[model samples]
Target: MRPFPLLLVLLASASLSAADVTPPKGETPPPATDLLGNPTDVPTVSKEEAAVLVVQGKEAMIESNDNPRRSVDAAVAFSKALKYYETTGDTDTICDLEANIFWCKKRMNLDDVKSFVAQKSGDKTVVAALAKVDKVANKEVTADKADEYFSRAEKFASKNPENFEQISVRYFEVAERFVGTEVGIKAQKLSLVAQQNQMKAIKEAQDAQRETLFSKPTKLNGKIQQTAVPSTDTQKSSASSIRTLYKSDFAKRKPNQKQNLLNKLMDQARTTKDDPVMLHALLTAATDLAMECQDFYAVISASDLMAMNFSGVDATAQKKTAFGKSKNPTVLAIIKLLDNPEDGDANTIVGKYFCYEAQKWDLGIPLLMHGTDADMKSLGDMEQLKPDGVAQQIELGDKWYDIGKKGRKGQPTLEGPMGRALYWYQLAEPKITGISKDRIAKRMDEIDSLLPMTNLNYESLTAKQWDRLKGGMAVISAAKDRNDIGLRLTAGKKYRIVPHPTDTWQPTTYYSSGNSRSVNWKGESLTNTPNTRQFIYFTGGDFKEGAMVMQIENGKWMKPGLVEGDGRLWLGPFSDYAWGAGGKGEIRIKILPADDE
Candidate 1:
């Protein structure tokens, strides 16, 4: 807001001096292990020498006139001299020679030293020098020269002690350093950006993974069992990175990281082979990383399966079909594992499921069709959408939401935004025959409105939830979408998973053999008979009969029906015993203002 000329003058001075910066000692410090990783090492100067050095440097800067370049040179010299003095502490370098350097011949300048002192390290002698330089930059010095001088001045000021913006300056300096460099300047810049982004991604992913894997804790039998890896995020990131880098011309370039992602992936596939429906996330994660560094470019040379590397290893010729073919060994192994003793197309059904879920839908759909002798429409409505699509992606999100809510006890655990969304999704599903179409439509609508805002995923679901909802629900394995989570509860027994926010808890004080009704709708044991019966459902609103929120009228799991009268909500199937399910112990869902009763 200052006038243009004054602004320009301030700008010129700003280039050289932002604020007070303590000058470096004239002598360099002793060659300590360059602890800060900088190029140079210097020793500390004697107090007397450091003081004198500041005075002389002040004098030099003051007399630099309009020349920012000269000012910068003087500052650099001062810095170097400080380095040298600290290194040797020679009395001459430290003190006497400093006064003579600026005062030699016709340049015996005094007034300038005072200004320099006031502007720089605040030593009196340099105040005169600063005033002189400021005057020069304001009047005699051209704009360009002022900029140059200011830049130098800023550089000097940057070296001042107690300047915490070192990292910010370092970035600009690095950018400037590469301004006219020969090789890979642009590439380096791009790579720098990518590296930053990659770091952010690595951090977030590792954080989320750790959070999911270790989100909850409970005293099980008065003993604690750890279900998740303990702060091994760095290791996982390293593994993930290795695979990502490998996916990009890995054979041509050696992987900088050391973890063997491919081997880990194969091992995961082997162990998880039996669970054809389970999404083996570790395997997929390893695959994601390996793909980043692996050779995707297919060569035209005559080749066996190993001749063309899509994955890390040289594949066997038995796996070969033609050139540039990416035959997934994991998928194949999974397919082999799924081939069943029970029936003809059951194995292929599993294969189709995994293939499609893996996003190799092209491969999976075909396989499924071959076995079924019909199009995929019969299995389920085959609607594939890009990760962000409304119909496909949103619906997918909603489905995951439901799995977290309605799943059985002691299996998958999920909470938080992910849990809330999953709860919403669970509440949304059409209960084929149990609930009417209108209710399903209304709940689905509610879920649709929620998922976009929540941004939850499947993996965030507990391992148990993942198994029952995704694994048990789907005939084949679901695709492991990085964008969407595929949760599974691994060690619920090890950790304490309490009630989630969306849970509907029905306190059982009584039980009956038949509820005095013809049909026992919800299959619950009728053992105890407590007069006080309470069915608690975590719906945001109360449930009325025939409402989608809860079938107060006879619905799935509720045999005789629930009746509300006189502010008393009667929840039934009138069972004496009720089973409870807690998600994997690793996940915890603390509602907003968490636990604020």
Candidate 2:
């Protein structure tokens, strides 16, 4: 049961009472006739009977109290009374009865009252109205009719300037209905104008009301008094205000001003130990501003202080993990650079650590350029001076690979060294040719084989591989393969995909689905199943289910297909609906850039 507003009930009652006017006492009632005043076979009721039925319908409606099931009963009674009034040509009573029936049906959630009445009375007017409604509901905008539709909407908008809401909706509808058409493009622009106008009108009204409210004086104890307004300057010394200034104003200041600000902020942080909010804010401002200013010494100092004193539950832990504590020579050298940014020996050690160990080229290359290591510094200088020189890039890659191989000792491949080598090689891959390309490919394969195959680890890996060069192998875990891989595919760029020999997975112990590139389900090919659309291609026949599938950004899933449109790549087992749920084992895939067509 849905309760209606009291106003609706009163209106319904008023209509009922006005239409239920009793015939003058002892006056003879007019003979029954059809709407056209012609003889008809339609059933008619006496005036007394009609009156009784109306009373009964009203009673039923009152008792219904907006309950859906009870309202149906009221609708039936009103419908019968409506028929009698229709046959007797009592237009006023007929209209009232129809309204009551409509209301009852409306309460029961039956909104197609026009069709219901049209069918019941066979009224041409009601039928015409229903047909018009159906036409609008089923309207389709095509190139032929797009202009006409746009013109009509424009005309309506011109006629009703104040009704911007409806005008906006109408224009937007035209835009959506005929997308890609000229009218649609025009409509979209007009729709934005109408929406802006609507917002402007609403804002103007609100501003006027606000001004009136604040401008008017209030009476207190028969005396007019002014309202007190809060001052913005009161919050100037707040921690949030400090943070806001750091973000919005810090960068615009001169270098010496920046230094002064950083010193003042650090002093405040050191002194305001009791106020954790202010302390954290001041330290954060100093640290971030120093980082932006490339004052590594200040950054290290402020960060260490914050780490020691921050009271946040996870702050210390997070800082410790990010700025790891170690006695390693490389770490100590990096620490030395904090005291003197120009220390060549320390920079050399720190640069190799970032390049060969951390595999963060963005952080490592600049340091390498400043370091004393002749070969590493030369490569870094070449990268900065001639970034697109393929031969130099390849030579640099060879240096890294050779050094990584030598550094391995008796252990497995050094991930950082090998990753750095791979990064340089990949940068040179698209341009190198013949034996050089084959050599690089072989080296990459060897590196890929030596690297451990494991699920994508967010803690140690990045979401996209366009920057970092960890390895060639991308591990697709059966448990969580829906995640996007680091590989980004450009539109129409060909890529060579090679599955690792160990690329095999099973949906369950009972179902061993060979390799991820090809899989079988019982005797029937799961690829033939219509449910395959849910996994990959909307048209499913191209690729097998349970095979490796790729999605382009948030677009449709499909086979890797080598040459894909521009988007990030994702690899996963193709399973319909279940989507590799409860699957075991992992898929290792190697994606390489192919020569451009």
- Reference-based lDDT, each prediction: 0.30, 0.52
Q: Once model 2 is optimally superposed onto the true structure by TM-score, how far is the C-alpha of residue 164 displaced, in angstroms? A: 46
Best by TM-score: 2
Across residues 1-597, which tens digit of lDDT does each residue of candidate 1 receive? 000000001121223321222234673222223432212322234444444444545443333432332343244334434444545656444332232222221122233333444344443223222322222222332333333433442443356423212212222233333344432243234334434544455456444322210121211222222122223564456455545744633343334231234444444544542332121234334444444433111110112112122223232232232222444553333334333322225434433433322323333433443344343323322322112112333355454445435543332222222333433333333122244445544554443443332222332333233223311111100111011112222321111111122222222222221122111112221121221111111111232211112122233332121122222112222222222222111112221210101
lDDT of candidate 1 at residue 366, scale 0 to 100? 32
Off by over 4 Å in 2: 1-326, 409-414, 454-597
Clashing pairs in 2: 491-566
Best by lDDT: 2
How would you encode candidate 2's per-residue C-alpha lDDT over 1-597 as one tens digit per residue?
111121122122222211122123564232243553322322344554456556655555544553334454455445445555666777556645544554453344333343344344643322222222222323454689788668777877888988665566567657766888888999988878877786687667644332211122322222212122223353335556786766644655776467657777877776773555556567666776765554444555565565555333243243333345556565467556655666788877777765554445656667777779797777776654433346767877787787677766433236666666666766566467678879987887676665544312222222133223333767776666475667787765767544443245554322211112233221112222210111111113554445566677777766543546787776666665435545666766666564331
What's the TM-score of each model vs. the native? 0.19, 0.29
Instruction: State each model's C-alpha RMSD to the native.
Output: 27.5, 27.1
Candidate 2 residue 244 C-alpha distance from true site, Å: 29
